[model samples]
Target chain A: MGNVGNVWAVVAIALVAVATFSLGYRGSRHASTTQDFLVARRTVRSRRNAAAVSGEYLSAASFLGVAGLVLKDGVDALWYPIGFTAGYLALMLFVAAPLRRSGAYTLPDFVEARLSSRPLRRVSTAFVLVIGVLYLVPQMQGAGLTLGMVLHTPGWVGALLVAVIVVVNVFGGGMRAITVVQAFQYWLKLFAISTPVFVMCAVFIGSGGTHGGESRGLAEPLPPTFSAPTSIDVTTPVTLRVVEPVWLSAEGRVDGGSARGPVFWGPGTHEVDADTKLMFPGGAPVPSVAGTPSTNAEWLTPTGGGTSDLWTTYSLIFALFLGTMGLPHVLVRFYTNRDGKSARRTTLHVLLLLGLFYLFPMIMGLLSRLYVPELLVTGKTDAAVLALPGKFLSGTLGEILGAVTAAGAFAAFLSTSSGLLVSVAGVLSTDILKGRVRDFRYAAALAGAVPVVIAVFVRPNDISMSIGMTFAVAASTFCPVLVLGIWWRKLTPAGAGVGMTTGGLCVLGALVATTVSGYTGNWAPWYLQQPALITVPIAFFTMILVSKATQRSVPADVNRFRLRMHAPDPLGFIRDRDVARFGTAEERARLAEGRHRR
Target chain B: MTTTEQKPDWEEVQASPDFVLLRRRLRRFVFPMAGLFLVWYLLYVLLADYAPGFMSTRLFGNINIGLVFGLLQFVSTFVITMLYVRHANKNLDPVAEKIRNEVESRGEEK
Candidate 1:
């Protein structure tokens, strides 16, 4: 809220961008060949690759959105970070090592190699672009939200700024650039996010603020009480469900009446017009948005009273648990490993890094409910983490801490957006532009530009929920293709193509239906809200049954490719063809024999 | 073609006892491990969704059954990772490297 702090945050963000560019440029010095641009020549060490993976994975959804969800919804929302981190576990178990052994630079490359079909590659490419762009929009919108909060600028300004920075970084070095920059960002983000929490925690203790055991004002049987006199500024029109009558001072219209003085809101849903300032005296139960849980008990439970919580919870779990393997950006990073063994190792480290970083957001989320209760009314709960330090810690220190969080949030947007752009660009250049570096630059521009423009126009209310829907789409489509394609040697190209199309269309249709219906209660089937539950099984069944029915269409060399994918490098069953490209004739012969198994 | 050339057919190599053994070892570990983990995870998810009161059964001041179960997911992942790595190193890697040496030496001689 301080102009000086906002100016400092802007300056810090610019410095981080410049630093990222320099780091990327340095990494790009090794990027003379396409291999360098594509998979960093598969030279990054496991630990560094793990850090980069963690950096890219902890996007706007994890950084700010998780905390906001927790603050607003209570413990039920903690499942998000858990599912997000654990998805890598599912990845490690099923996809990670084998995918690296597949020796493909991109998802489409893997699809083409495995299925041995150009048309299948084209289909895979379309899905890659869809998932990448869908994932990218949320990061851009999150950047806009952060800028709007920190600097009081138009949201598009920050979104455009992030897009330009990502495009520049990718244009400079592609995957090589993103690797070093992202690894560095992981530490920078960890430091930026955790420091304020630690400082504020100490400050909280020093000020005799006991941790935990405090009543959650909303969860109690009675209505939530404000710990102190609070002023809530309604930025958007809201219908507040009041439990107890409270006399509050209002400057704008309340329930269609322009009130300049004290007005009483009875026990019912009251429409508070936009731009209204409602001041509630201390100990009065805080009114909440209609249909959301207004008590602490409701907030803690899974069936906490919105859209059939059972269906929503299971659907979300199915999507996230299976979806991580399908995220193109995440899958692309695994290719940076030198071998299957390292890829497995890197994923193990990612699990640890993600677990550690998530703890801070959980703490911050709980802190928000205690310190920033007014966020519930403003519906800007996404800003909970950014606003917490300022709410609790006063003076110069608090402003600087807020700036730190702002910088971390910007880092989140930059690292994730850059990773998504690079993956998308990789697909575009390799599939459409013949894997040329110059083409990659053009692809980067197209990849980054589309999302930024959409983010400017179409604003999703909850950042994490939008990301969840993207996960649902990804889970339905790629998860089946990758899992069955890797494990089930019976899978045919037609089966994969049909299954993917079916899953993708079903999820897309559900998404459009849900959007068109406009969040009305029970308008769409609950499965439509979380389509993975229905679509994932459909994908698997379609692939299995069709592949069974068309066994004659199976590739003749399925067993050879299967050996190449499953066998470790020590078995010499799989080799990096890129490395063999520059080798002598005999060396190339060895690599070919390794693959062809002469 | 060299008289001593010994280029084995991919079909033979795949059906060879060594390859079969390798595939079996991998399947023996991955299938059961993946199944157990998935079941454990989904059970927690089901309980969280359907049995809210049970999940909310507090253990400590505010720490509840659900929180513990959620935290266990992270712990189980790390544990499984360690077990799989150890399993690969102990059971899978030696035979795999032996097969590689046999194939490469025979190919070079040819």
Candidate 2:
């Protein structure tokens, strides 16, 4: 029965892959020009474009990672999803229309357009590469984990397979194709998550239910070990040194504690708490436990801390809310739309789609707490979602559920990686390689290869942590650039160039410090992991101060550019007559033929 | 091609009824609502930070103030979105339509 179920799971994954490739190939037909390849000729519907945005945004981090975190950590993990979805709201309010209006293909393009500086563009391009590669690592890692769980293959093999597929898809069709695949994947993910949850709920309710009934011994006080201080920042790698294995009951209370509760361990619990000091792997000391028993089990539980862990919690929230605006993949999707209004509408759809999808993962996390508490002890918390089907139902139903999850996991990886590749390709072609398509394709392959190598070698401590690191880098650098460039018209090229370089360097420096310092008792542990609390404000202030100092350096065309951005384009804004003046023979012929036909 | 034509200031352009109504509505309601929510979210964060005891205070069986605050962050997002959509539909949409008509007519004349 397990074999049959596994075969079905494999088949389902194969079907999804084939469908995705065909869709991408079909999209390539429409992507003959660089513009079409980059932004789908800027004519995509707002609704579909929004779906693609949300779809790409919902990575392994959202689907499997958050659920796993919730299963391991408890209610505190809910913040991850909330922060992620709220990012779209921020994007809607601040970024959507202005970004579309800028008429730039990539973030670097926006930098150049806003500051009119090639040097600034180069700096932003470099940041994009770093941020893109950072983001790509988690997606690759998640792909490996998901494939390993679903197909019983080695994790590295799964990672390589996903990297190859993503590279091909992005190389073949570019942004246009990725948009279609992402939109489709969004719905696929929604169904994948929702169906099993609905089935599990029904099955649980039908079989002499465990609903709303507090089981006896489930009210024990959490042990000191369970309540020990762990590094909360998602961006920095957490090194959990288990001096001893701390066993807890399903209720997350210490197993041998006088106050008995439901014991949680193995695959079900959201977080694993061993008698270990959680720090970065290199030996930096994270926050240590103050030996306080949490008042609320839901809050005080290590994985399920109530909002008391301020730095970790707020840093995460800040990352999610502000991070969306800076994400290259999500931003590039907006450029695919027809105009500013379309971009706005697309953002609205993304909000709804993402909000709906978040509900299931939260529920899954909560359910895992109740059912699969054993998995926590194994420290294989990521498998919480994949393990759900077998725990709830057996035989054919279990296999089907497993297959659906596997497919969804792969979808999460493929959609996100493709989006990242497109963004990377855009920066390479437009900024670095000077609009050369062939060179851009080579860059795309290189981009995919770099992350795959990183994934294979580094093998990040956790998926959520890897994603958070990417967000810190993004929030520190691109977030400041986009925000300042939009609101402050006085922004000079030198100022922007300086600000971006500073912000990017600060984030990179922090990342390096955190990585090299490891779990040792180093000051870098606290500061470097959550650098945004410092670097973001610094970037903002620097940009403003620099722009003020260099106000006169602003070009004469600044006003004209602002007017063009804010005002609606006039009818025949780009007339054939205008192009004819600068036209090659082929363009002139096309214009003359169009005029004669009209 | 009249590059020398004096461009009207935003204030003068906004003196039209359509713009006036939008400006009033945005100031009186939408802006205030957004401000209030932003404050609430910030307060929640501050409390979670400085007043961990307060955040840790339990409300129901195993439910703490921090959990409620975190959940409220989710609720507030939906609330703001719904409020925005309602405002756009009831107040902003008509004004926007009028502006669109004016802009379209002006474009046609050009």
Candidate 3:
């Protein structure tokens, strides 16, 4: 089937933009000072801040990639969402209260303030840049994929569209606008993903709750069959591996030879060139793609029945569980809370919200198996969530639901990309541009520009895998420093720097090697693909060993610093008493005194 | 920026019995709980990775042990968070506030 017309998609995109900017404009009224731009003046309530965090954190990875991974890799990919939400649990337990109480606006700011070292701050800023840029690429790629499916336009159009919108939003009103905009986006995404799934479930149940296909026997390795006459237009060159000789009506290049109708394929890999249309009659089992399961049993197992699955699985868990605390955009949100208690409460709320949102994607992924199995051969499993509405329901209502899912997908890119941009711009403006609002505008431009350039050049094979790599890097590098610096008083600046550099370089080298070598199996390929399992332990040891070796360099006031971080804020009383203006002069004096001790 | 250079009397506060008690209480809750949660989470991951047969074994109609384990990750997180909040409020917060109040009130005179 051709894509739904552009009118609905354009309207949906316009509505999301109008709603986002309108909320931002309202929030901008309160945003005047640099503090307002950076941390929303520390005035946001726990519930609102939680929603904003959930919104910004979801990104296209959760919105589209989770379901996509589940579709392609089986139940094992459920770890993506589980690890993602559980990371917050780790944050709540270890990082949330302490980081908030430290009173630093950015990760770099926290590193510098905690360690009393400007050089460590510079190292952290570099990581913030790398993670921010790496994360931004997938959001851009997801945007391109969505728009190409919905609008029938070139992929780059959607990427450029999101980049411009994000830049303008960040330039106009930094963190203040982002907070309000993202809070709205969380609910929008929840509604967009769930409403359609709920509707589909209801319809399925109403229609006897019976699936539309015959059950395959346990001994069968048969490919998935088209329940109806389905015509697939290949947008790019695809190589399909057939298990048995099958007949198909074909037009354009098939097996490097042009044929018009009734082409036969043998039991081997066949290349279908770009713009080729392949028509399969009813009950013709779909051809298997090069790297995906062709049967239900294979799709249901978590490991995809591969030898390297165990190592990769543990690595993903390591990366996601530890990585959430180090995300620059996520860390910056805690600074918007009124205090440490609010930060903890906000994270709790975030855990709940993220848990609820992930459920819908998992449902969508499961439902796609029954309705959109052709996606296996197409290698567009990412489109499963978007394609389900149209495939299962054949009417105007289905088209509308499809449009709504597309809009929600766009909203995902917008909210996440904006959060990342604001964070990157906040760091750039503060460190390089001296924290001026005008300079922030320039930083905002640079923040969005670099990722857009990368997105335009590199075509992502799997959006989720790319994001998982970024998480692995973040987990390996920053997770060590934050955990050690907060809990260990003897952690010197030199140790922190060395640990971060070692971890960062190792993960980066793994990423580079894997990308260059192109997934050559064996020789510890899974370790390279998911580097956190190896790199995180190495970094932790390096930090501990280096800190032990350089105990004399530990900041002398580390005891006082720990006291400030671990202490409960008695001013929480004043904060509750006066929500609007709670950062009192007395509290400032106390903070100033505590800082002096450090 | 200016706050980084100050020198408050941290040694005095760290020596106080109240501060010592507060640290002890916090460690009691944080270390054991953090350790427990990590072990639980790691067990789930290890089981999923190594014991795929156990994980994929269907416990109900199309509802396998793996899916249940995945959902429990969410259930357990919420439960842990609530438990920690309760534990902190009862055992940790009052003592922490007491220490903070003592330190801040004294620092004000300087």
Candidate 3 lDDT by residue in tens digits, A253-272: 98889989999888888998
Docking class of 1: acceptable
Q: Name the regions of candidate 2 deviating beyond 4 angstroms.
A: A1-5, A209-308, A434-436, A519-523, A569-598, B1-38, B48-68, B82-110
TM (chain A) per model: 0.93, 0.82, 0.92
Summarize candidate 1's per-residue lDDT along A120-193 as a digit string, tens digits.
Answer: 99999999999999899989999988888888889898899999999998988989889999999999899888
Q: Judged by DockQ cut-offs, is candidate 3 incorrect, acceptable, medium or high?
A: acceptable
Ordered from best to worst lDDT, the candidate numbers read 1, 3, 2
Model 1: CA > 4 A from native: A1-4, A210-228, A251-253, A256-260, A301-307, A519-522, A570-574, A579-598, B1-7
Q: Please give the lDDT score at residue A77 for candidate 3.
A: 80
Tens-digit lDDT string for candidate 2 (A424-484) = 8778876667665687698888889998888888735557767877887787778877766
**CAPRI accuracy category, model 2:** incorrect
Deviation (Å) of A52 in candidate 3 = 0.7
User: Which rank order by DockQ, best down to worst?
Assistant: 3, 1, 2
* Candidate 3 regions with alpha-carbon error over 4 angstroms: A210-223, A235-245, A250-260, A263-276, A304-307, A519-524, A570-598, B1-8, B108-110
Best by DockQ: 3
Tell me how far the alpha carbon of residue A285 in candidate 2 is from the true structure, in angstroms, after superposition. 28
